[model samples]
Target chain A: MRTYGNSASVVVLLAWLLLPFATARAESIVLASTTSLDNSGLLGRILPAFTAKTGIEVRVVAQGTGQALATAARGDADLVLVHDPEAEAAFMAAGHGKTRVEIAWNDFLFVGPQSDRTAIGGMTDAVAALRLVSEAGAIFVSRGDNSGTDALEKRLWRAAGIVPAGQPWYRDIGGGMGAALNMAAALDGVTLTDRGTWLSFANRRGLVELVHGDARLINRYRVIELDSVRHAGAKLGPAHVLAAWLAGAEGQAAIGAFVLGGEVLFHPGVREIPPGE
Target chain B: MEEFVPIVLRSLAVSLAATGFAIAIGLPLAAALALGRWPGRPIVVVMVNALLGLPPVVVGLVLYLLLSRQGALGVLGWLFTPGAMVLAQTVLATPIVAALAHRAIEGRWRRYGPTMQAAGASRWRALPHLVRMAARGVATAVLAGFGRTVSEVGAVLVVGGNIAGFTRTMTTTITLETSKGNLDLALGIGLVLIGISVAVSATVLVLAGERR
Candidate 1:
């Protein structure tokens, strides 16, 4: 008020310009990111390096994409990294995440026991494979926790025209990917899991990837900076930095390199690069 | 609604099976701990006391790690199976039973012990009376454990896999349907769980009260 001669609008402009730089100097920036970031060990690997370079400690709170966005909306997190596009779009429309950037993209796979028992490989579609599992009454484990993976699973069920709510063969673990995968492994059932967590826990079970690269499998991830106006603690500057870095060369390379058992976890970016010449 | 019936039944089967196994193992073990006084008894007692309120998620995590196909017990093929779930529930319930029994037997040594000793009866004679006096409290413990085994969502969700018509239990069913925005099925399962809990408490109280 004193600097702007009691002008509210100019005071707002000054406040907007000054916050992130001052925040970077004084406070740690907290981010509520997704399970993929945490589970793939990307955040664990890169956050420390980012901190070492920037002198700003990035405290990444990891949760499922739905929960991460919801956490940001509640102002618990200054930013969010999420996978579910529809849910992410809803959050942006609601004025939560003001800046969004495609950070990485992966694919979901219908994984099962390696005996080729269901024979849904090369089917070129998710619904047909789901139907085969249903028709055969082969077991299928679901995350069922309303997570991003769970949401994707539900979308496929709609496409497959199978209401799996009460299906005897369908199992919903109502948990995170790790636990759900454990159950799927035990039962030798079909399940749709993120390639990251699946690969991390792959060797633990009898399960193998049955389907991938289908349109339904296109799992894209993005980072969004929380609108600081709505959230008092939003670290807009570093959040955008992180997001931009993720969409840049080094970050894309990191995404492609994140692996388990020598299998690439994510397919990096299919988004267009900038114009040349 | 018809589709969920089978799921509910499967959950009930798992819940009942876990409860039965808990009682089967917890009761005898609890009885032994309550009556036995030996070296490390206090330590065992303390550990059991601590485990009485163990969070379902923690138990689930330990069990998951131990039983995951890549885990140490993975070769046993128990992860996500009913057996692993039973093992987790049993671990959770055993401490509850032991703690309750320990508390029930806390102060009855003077009057009951002397009376039985004066009657020319052995340690066995005093045993039944101790059992009789502590019956109601022990029953409450069992009932509490049963309620927990049925109402728990985390452990079952983690360990049991909530497989419909397979490992799905009522608690996890309620969680799944509620999260999926299926209110009717969730409510139905919730109401059934409440009924089961009430029935269990009432039956234990009545039976224990009769014995006293």
Candidate 2:
């Protein structure tokens, strides 16, 4: 009986300790977002200010843009912050999102080893540089995870009129931006990466930006509020609050203010115009 | 880092809570399986034993499907929370504790069954005595369950979403930092986790020595 009492008391104590975790906070919302945004430390830098101002806790689940959209589609998240415009349009057309707004923009860079084997260094034309890399059969690491970056890479390959797939020079590692960058560093290969993640990444052994400022290389990040009518469990109020806050002046300033190593990561206040305008 | 302390504390609290739930459900099932004579007893024992090898990722995926907003149990809204992580860890640790406890209690039942039966003790009546006599092994089984829950990252990662300062455990943090190419921070967290494992093992050894 003594042992039973002691164990029962211990169980009660554990339950007491876990009670807070079992309950949901009314002002809290889940934001499904991309690894680029998270790995860049941008969200870490700005989210605390949002939370402090609104008293709303934002829990971010950082995945690829495709997975982030899919997570919101499944009603697992109240909002999504991603950079894949085509996928975001498709998700909106599918009625998974109520509202979408572009919050920031960053350009992608063609990064490769400093050896410049294909002589793509200081190249302004992304398509031509990719063609050179492809013709030279230089090792190119691909994200291949249906992320926004992967989508852009596919488009670039299409423009170059070359199928790097089934070629030994192309390494399609279905992973995040950081993973692709790490692989690129390890193999001394070339890869496309967002400025944010590339700036924050620390494992670069010999990689350097080879191509940038192409019209097709702009990466735009947007925040979408999940449709509460479709998903009853969606924290619509808090989600709307967060979405509005992100597009508003304070959030835009915060995004602009986020810097790493004396370089601004994202340009804010780029509103998305309605299509067919 | 200043954040390291909270992460360690959260990991301990979550795993400890999960181990408590595993013990609450597993010990009775273990007792019943080890001491009772029932139809399909062999199959039940075999199934429990087989479940000992259940993959954490598979368990995580299934639990994710079950707890997602589209899932049947979605109304409970447990996904991406510490609650969900605890539930996943409980599912993972339960079978381990049960199978290990079953093995230990079965051995005790084999040695004491006839004598207890001659004294008119039914299996239910003899359960407490057997458990008490096999206390050391049972404690080890509990420790094994704790170890499993503390070290596992897959299930928690799937269900908890690895939200910083919320559902992030030591293993999940290590995974996240490594993926972010912060190998030094990841190694630091890994060393902390290893230190914890070593401490738990030392405690187990001390208990064993005391029993001897």
Candidate 3:
């Protein structure tokens, strides 16, 4: 009995001793980001070095792009790393964000079971591919979380002139990119996902990329600092610093070098890269 | 419907495993706190009770830090797995079990302690009999733990990553679907989660009635 008491106290003491070191210090800034980027292993690759070099600790909160932007709007976070271009524009137009700077780019891909049940492979036109998949009544899983990928999928469906909501073949999983990918792998359904998450996903379960390289499939990530002058108490200084860092040479190089499973998942400001380069 | 099978089964398995571990460890801790005489016992009891309200996200965050790639226990690599879900659930459940089981056992201990002491029986000797006498209470404690873990999302979502056919339990699925605006799917899963809790309560009642 005495032994158990002593051991319990020791365990509790150890926990208390370690608690302070586990959390970021007072100098840290919260950076809200999309789950796709966080789960893609990009932030983990870059943030440690970012913190090490600049002594500006970035505490990342990975939510969907919509949620991340919402966090910034609420003044809960200093900066937002998000990919929903439409939402980013809306945020800036609404006078919530100071500016949006392109940091990196990745394309979305239509991936599915290796069997290619929809036969939409080799298709470069995203809308046409989606139209064919819808016409065929093939299974298409959706993340349904109103994420950047979800928003893109909705736009594609609209472009294809289809409302896939009630279709038996259309399933909404309502999860993040990885969860949707796992569902696609499990159910042998087709789903659209960001290239970064697709590259990091491990449980392929025979899933393969079927369609990509469409102009509409391009995914652009941006860093936005809140307009702190309007929204008082916003951490404007660190947000600007981090945003500049991400758009600068070192951040671009870090993004260019990030690889998973031997594949470079994102191109740093891909629009800036010349055709020959 | 077929897709939901794995989700429901996984939820049950993880919550059940969590409850099992909670009971295994909690009962002894509850017994120790209830039966043993110590100076700091009141403080220990208060701490355990306070832990019953431990935020699920904090539990998830702690476990996540302890299990991430850069975490101290990252070598196990259990993050984003069903194993991680179970571990997080266990953390959430253990305190509930300990606090509730202590309440249940303490009453019985008070009644049995003096009698045993008069009979020249050691404090430890009364534990088994007291536990048996307090079986219904312990069962309630187990149910409480199960109830908390079965429908929890925050901790499991953080640790489990909510992957399909791996870590996507009913609660996590509901949370995801709700955020995605898939109310139909979310409602369906929500009903199933409620159904599970009802079924558990029914079974517990039936067994208790039979014992009576």
Query: Candidate 3 falls in which docking quality class?
Result: incorrect
Q: What overall lDDT goes with each candidate model?
A: 0.69, 0.87, 0.79
For model 1, how does the per-residue alpha-carbon lDDT over B96-156 read when each residue is reduced to its tens digit? Answer: 7767766775545445767777888776556677778878777877777777776778887
lDDT of 3: 0.79
- The superposed Cα distance between candidate 1 and the true structure at residue B16, in angstroms, equals 37
User: How does each model score on TM-score?
Assistant: 0.53, 0.92, 0.63
Deviation (Å) of A100 in candidate 3: 0.9
Best of the candidates, DockQ: 2
Runs in model 3 deviating more than 4 A are A1-18, A21-26, A270-277, B1-99, B102-212
Best-to-worst ranking by lDDT: 2, 3, 1
Model 1 earns a TM-score of 0.53
The true-versus-predicted C-alpha distance at residue B81 of model 3, in Å, is 22
lDDT of 2 by residue, A76-157 (tens): 9988999887888899888787777889998999999999799999988999999999989999999999999999999999
Identify the superior model by lDDT, candidate 1 or candidate 3. 3
